[model samples]
Target: MFKKLDFFLFGWIINWMYPEYYRPKYGYQRYYILFFHYLIPQKLFRLNPKVRWPVHFTSKVLAAENIKKGILCDPGDNNNNYIQANNGIIFGSNIELGPGVSIISSNHKGNNLREHTKGKPITIGNNVWIGANSTVLPEVSIGNNVIIGANSLVSKNIPSNSVAVGNPCRVIKPKEDYSEDLSVIIFNKKIVEKFDVFLNSNV
Candidate 1:
């Protein structure tokens, strides 16, 4: 009806307004929300001042201004993800947050229902992957090259090169081949090589 026509018009407008969205193969870049049922509403959320990076339409990032995230990351890619960084949060590059993951940086005070307790910022290092349905509590520091398994609850600090899982999220194994500099270089090289391949398939 009118809604379909409205989106059609908006899509055309977007194509015209933002030439930077154009690609050689795809023509004009269109995000998942554009074709999906959730359209303009999610677009508005992405433009909000509280949003630090692209978030899934169903995800919510409260107090995102308090978070310092490096490189590109979509916190809630699949859905139902929430990042509450009221206290503050620092994230290094190449961080992946699976669906239903929650990173909470503040907690409600016991004495006062409305008031929140001050906590240290959650500091996450590079190349960390927090699995689906995982919950990272306030003031937890996870070092580089860490993988928090699915449905895990991170309550304390997790050191580098660790693979952890459980209700209390403990490290079960240490990664043998993990280098911070190599990780960053590999990611960057992959991105660069991908674009090069797109431009020159023979190359």
Candidate 2:
């Protein structure tokens, strides 16, 4: 009961203090709402049907018509006004999207920046792990079990079971099943040699 009051008070104070800032910027408002929604206990706000938290929309979040469940969005992930056709975004169970991730589903037609034309939709496969601050452009299909490294800008399609990284990301390694644990799969001789002290401790 007291916690609910605190949540409302905090939101009210933010609204009161920054009316101009919060009114126009939907992104900021969404962040504020989501912060309180998840941070506070679900019991208090669950009763209020009117308090629908906003999903931080970026230049990439086409229409919200096709968004699915089991998506863990970091505070920095922004989906623009990308159209969600037939529920384009199909995330698998246990997908973690890090901060500053941008999943763009549509683009403009003309070269002129002022025009309002639409482009293609983005399709992300199941069990895909997108790292922090990644940008996924339109008309691209990322295959299942793909791991995209942090800060990568994906402009094309990525094959299944691959590791892609860097600016305008390129495939670093093909999909392969290893019998060893995750630590062995990711770290090679270089890492093991350099961090022998820490690795030995874990072992």
Q: Name the candidate that leads on lDDT.
A: 1
* lDDT of every predicted structure (CA atoms): 0.66, 0.50
lDDT of 2 by residue, 22-128 (tens): 12122123434545543242224432121122333332334444554332222123332222333255443324565667776555556876643555456676456
Clash count for candidate 1 is 0
Give the alpha carbon lDDT tens digit for every residue of 1-203 in model 1: 55445446555554343222222212222433433422344455443234534455777778877877654344544478888889999986567888899999999999997988997999998678999999999999999878999999999999998999999999999965444343222221124333332223212
- Reference-based TM-score of each model: 0.69, 0.50
User: Which regions of candidate 1 are displaced past 4 Å?
Assistant: 1-39, 45-49, 178-203
